[model samples]
Each structure stands twice: as C-alpha cells, then as structure tokens.
Target: MSLNVLAVDDSRTMRDMLNLALSSAGFTAHLAEDGLHGLEVLSEIEPDVIITDINMPRMDGFGFIEALRSDDRWSRIPILVLTTESADELKAKARSAGATGWIVKPFDPAKLVKALQMVAG
Candidate 1:
C-alpha cells in the first residue's frame, strides 16, 4: 500500500528532499510550509503519517500535535518529529504533545522510509 504522508516544515530544501525521498519510496507526499498550512492541508488529505519540524512561523510542532490530538478524526495518526534539536527535553515535550516518534535532523532517507512504513503501514 502507498501510505500518504503530510510533511510540515518551513524550509523549502527540506520539503524538496522529503518529497523526493517519499516519492522514491512510493509514498504519496504532501508538503506544508508551516503548522497552520499543515492544518489547512489536513482538511484535504487524510495522511497515514505526519512529519513535522519543531520550530515554525505560525504554529510550532507542539501546538500542531496538540491540535491534531484534540481532533478525534486525526488523533490516532502517527506523527514523527523531524528537527535539528537533539535535546532530550525537546523529545519529551514532543512526546507529551502526542508525537509517535522522533528523528533528529539530517535524517537518513532509508531510515525515514522504514520508520514511516513501520508506523503507518
């Protein structure tokens, strides 16, 4: 099955890289510039998995996760935090906000694909 993915990040390069990696892995990928945009896209696409950056312009990953967890329709979907922050405190915070997993930035494409499949497939 081709798992659908929604990736929220402010970096264009990261979005492009994710698009390439996800498409190469046969996953349908959607990109959003920020958490608010991610929410807007969420209205249109039912993604099995979500990958989001911690820092963003409008709504941060914590807020985004909180919003999703509050919505029954989207609460159970797997969310992976992809960020440059490697601090344990941040990971705990993301977990508290309802993240399913964590991935430090400069992610490996193969590992990312594997993680998505393991969680969403």
Candidate 2:
C-alpha cells in the first residue's frame, strides 16, 4: 500500500528532499512549513504517517503532536520526529507529546521508507 505522508518542516530544502524521497519510494508526500501549516493540511488529507521537525515558527513539533493527540480524528496516527536536535531530554519530551518514533536529521531515505512501511503499512 502507498502510504500518505505529511512532512512538517520549516526548511524548503528539507521539504523538497522529503518530497523526493517519498516519491521515489512510491508514497504520497504532503508538505507543510510548520505546525500550523500542518494542521491546515491535516484538514485536507488523512495521512498514514507524519514526520515533523522540532523547531519552527507559529507552532513547534511538540505542540503539533499534542494538538493531534488531543483530536480524536488524529490521535491514532503515527508521528515521527525528524529534527537536528539529538538531546535525550528532547526525545523524551517528544515521546511524552505522543511521538511514535524519532529520526535524527540528515536522514537516510531507505531507512525512512522502511520506518514508514513498518509503522503505517
């Protein structure tokens, strides 16, 4: 099955890279600039998996995850944190916020695809 993925990041280059990686893996990718933009896009599509960055304007990843977890429509979806931050405390915080997994930045495309399949397929 082709997984519908939502990638929320403030970087245009990161968004472009994710789009390429997902497309190459035969998955549908939806791009969002930040947490707020992600929420807006969430209204339009039901994603199988979500990949988000930690730092952003308007709303951060933690806030985004919390918001999603609070909504019945999105609570069960898997959320993966893709960020440059590698602090253990931050990971714990993200976990508490309802993240399903964590992946450090400069991600491997193959691994990301595998993770998405494992979690969403």
Q: Name the top lDDT candidate.
A: 2
TM-score of 2: 0.98
- Candidate 2 per-residue lDDT, tens place, 1-121, comes to 6999999999999999999999999999999999999999999999999999999999999999999999999999999999999999999999999999999999999999999999896
Cα error of candidate 2 at position 6, Å: 0.5
How much is the lDDT of residue 83 in candidate 2? 97
Lowest lDDT block of 10, candidate 1: 112-121
Cα distance off (Å), candidate 1, residue 44:
0.4
Q: Report RMSD (Å) for each prediction in the order shown.
A: 0.6, 0.5
TM-scores for every predicted model:
0.98, 0.98
Cα-lDDT of candidate 2: 0.97
